[model samples]
Target chain A: MSETAQRGGAIPPNSATPLVSLRDIRLTFGSHQALRGVDLDVMPGECLALLGDNAAGKSTLSKVISGTYIPDSGTITVQGEEVRFTGPNDARSRNIEMVFQDLALCDHIDVVGNLFLGRELNKGPFLDQKAMLARAQEMLEALEIRIPRLTARVEKLSGGQRQAIAIARAASFQPKVLIMDEPTSALAVAEVEAVLSLINRVKAKGVGVVLITHRLQDVFRVCDRAAIMYEGTKVAERMIADTNLEEIVNLITGGH
Target chain B: MANYTERAKQSHAVEWLNDNAQVLSIALFFIACMGFFWALTDTFMTTGNLLNVVRQGAPVLIVAVAMTFVIMTAGIDLAVGSIVALINALAAILMANGFDWVTTSVMMLAAGAVVGLAQGWFISFQGIAAFIVTLAGMSILRGIALYITEGYSIPIKDQAGFFWLGRGTLAGIPVPAILAVLVAIIGFIIMRNTRYGRQVVAVGSNLEAARRVGMPARWIVCSVYMMSGIACAIAGLLIAARLGSGSSNAAVGFEMQVIAAVVLGGTSLMGGRGSILGTALGALTILIIGNGLILMHVSPFLTQIVTGVIILLAVWMNTRLFGAGFKLGKKG
Candidate 1:
């Protein structure tokens, strides 16, 4: 176990294979080819920022990888074993999770209930409220999100807090590769920082993260490696420390 | 200048009132209605009148509970009234054919499930518009009911125990009322506390997001229709017991009443927003209005038009008054 952990390429100096390896991924919707032979590897414990503008096929690629839409042709390998995800649940079962931009939370329900949503922790016939609440409390605490009322309806929560709950929900499943689609797009600056901090904390656990965002600042701050998507293909890949934002922006717009 | 603070406080209060105008207006209407009835009539608050109110509200409440789930997904079921008619006719015909009570009861209830499955499949899996599928279902089911009974009321004679499913009471409360409360509690648990329940609301609010999160959007959408159908079947059974017969035209205007109650309770017809509690209250409010009109000697035909206007007004108010303060996010 330690051998695999240490030899994981992006995990550490001795870490094992990349957690997610997408090779020659191609997808088209209607007449548009959203992803054109895109190739990338998400190593364990590393934050890979997928940076691009609108129509850069960032959303489409994320969906394909997360099982929202199957790739027209591609090979997705987890830990060196190729797998095909037919749907979101299939991806999730393989420990690949996506926290969508919308959060996908039920507003009428309270915090604890929303956290568990599809993957509920149950006891016999009834929902184990005590058990779920305790686990949720622990998860929130781990994420350092202070939701004063666990029973507070999600509609009543502020934007930042709701985002926190959503992130915490994704983390609850203990996913190996957590994909976030512009998780900070709707947040204020302070809320963005909060999410950034949470992302950093998750990174400490060695969970590989694929962050889909247009924010170059977030890429610089949190990501170790940045992959640029232009039109339907990956135009450039840069290490965060070695490259500046200007070149990446140029790559995104396909000028460089 | 002399009363600047006082003026400021008054303005602040008015601003606060404006912010909560939707809830405040509904409260004010309730108060005004109660006061008008109290002043004009002596027997308005009597137990007998209230019991009459419960009985009248029972059928609408049953249908609205189903509507709650449908509207939560931003979908509508127009076949409810027709479904009630069909179930009623099924029960009556089965009894006439010498079917045992338990078998007949299960068979009658199963009709709703079959209808729900058919319509739900089209709407959820087949990707048809809910309005068109249920509207077609409404026509088809009503025709089936009429054809089953030859457009006449079928008197139930053999299924004495089955009649109790609708008419039998526990302690002193009406069976339908008890059943309504039970259904509400179950609905409340599912909608407010369970994972499957949350998935329904999530899917209703935003299909793409729900799918990305690994929710079984198709199944959730389909189940809600089943729920609506079951509720309608229950209402049909109770109506048959109360009338001691089944007819094609039973609960003729029930869909309007159910939709009115759900809208009044603040469930958005646009999907992804609704509450069973609100739906129940909405049903009760409609019941109260009808009862008040009847007690005040208002004509039934006019009462329906008034009810329709009130529903329209309530929905309009929901948008105009509370739309700003309570704006729902694009996604759940």
Candidate 2:
């Protein structure tokens, strides 16, 4: 194993600055307080597992970081620079990418089209389909994902393949911070292994990864630190070496 | 360890057929309609009569092309027929007041864009349903047309050049027919090859997904309405040029015909799946039925009933037979 892997997916010891830091993030929708004054930090090359039960604000917190939601009150600092995001585009410009739990793919479009999505290659006014198809193959190949057809509509692909495409799209963009919400929730055992390894591959590049998952085994396998949320607030934070599945479950279930 | 079995690979021909099933079905229907008409009426197969059908079908074909874009986004512009009538009246009025045909035509197209943009703004930015907004537009526009002309058919004398656009033939082809063909070719190219076309499909397939990816989703939605408006303007001008007059009554129930053509061509009203070629075939099919029925001495009143039934049947076949999961043979 490499030195970083030996350290349980932590950033190299010499690096002190975090890739992203969220302080006192709060959000409300109508009468419901989805998140309340949550503070978190993700260091470069570290995989942070965010754990929570239902309605524990896991998805909300990640959305705030990804700019899907602007926190009602919070300060987000990226690489020691404070920033405010008006929308997902603002966050994307800063190399922040999110793999949405719903996959957020256009079903009518083919695989190559979805892989490029908003950033399509065009020869003047026309789409450069040939170039895009070639690049899509390379993108999937680099991830070791084998999709039988690139021109097939995304709706026709299996669940694992769809999830793989979503991850491939975000990872290919060289994001500084990657947020994945329940990426393995719907995958089979083999697909989960593929995704876990893919996450490791992305982490090896020094990108800060925040994985929101209910799967405790995934946290133990890949995370350096685990933060547990209960009822819209962070209950506890533990380094992977200092935590166990039973202790994390206690934290999530509101037990001491 | 879990084993993953690859999905069986389909042959190239089968895959192509599956992908193009909707368009292919519509193509076959169009040919069947032509064959049926040719057998029933000797004149229907003649060159001159066929040219006449193309000329008459030109306006519907032009608008149907634009409607393909609108329907692709899961939107409908019910006001299109009314907009055509309004522009038809406005063009004649402008020309009567000493405005040249060229300037009048340009101004009419601009007016169409303005009208479309207004409705698009309401639907896209203000969060109104496209059906409701365009429905209201339909009533308001036609009411304006009726109020302006006061039920009069205003004649446009002189301007042989303007009349040429409606009546003139190029190499024995009617000008309007030629214009409609050009629009279809352009629409096909745009839908198949352009970035804007991809954006349209993406937005239609999943609006939230398109927005999350930073596409100008609202703007794309609005632009399609503008395209519909431009097409209506062209259709209106063609009518006025051909008739040498304009009336508030022009293109009555025209939206039904255009929408019917689009849906019949296999463009899904649900949006995201459509073909301009399918729309062209659908329009031609409708025109052939109308012209052939008349030649067969069928009552003009019964023609409406037949057209409605055919539309229902075509759309039924489109959804039930040619829809997703439809296979050509036992292998599928």
The most accurate candidate by DockQ is 2
DockQ of 1: 0.21
Off by over 4 Å in 1: A1-16, A28-33, B1-39, B158-170, B312-332
Q: All candidates' TM-scores?
A: 0.84, 0.95
Global fold similarity of model 2 (TM-score): 0.95
Worst 10 residues of 1 chain B by lDDT: B1-10
Least well predicted 10-residue stretch by lDDT in candidate 2 chain A: A3-12
Q: What is the TM-score of chain B alone in each candidate?
A: 0.87, 0.98
* Pairs with steric clashes in candidate 1: A6-A14, A6-A15, A7-A14, A7-A15, A7-A16, A8-A15, A8-A16, B72-B272, B73-B271, B74-B271
lDDT of each residue in B1-332, candidate 1, tens digit only:
01001111224455455434445555565566667776777888887777657765687888888889998988899999999999999888887888876777688778788888788999999999999999999999999999988999988875666666566667766777888888888888888666677788888876876766667889889988998998888888889877788899898978888888888877777777677777776777778777787788879889988877877887787777666455322233
lDDT of 2: 0.91
Q: What is the CAPRI rating of model 2's predicted complex?
A: medium
Best by TM-score: 2
How far residue B4's Cα lies from its native spot in candidate 1, in Å, is 37
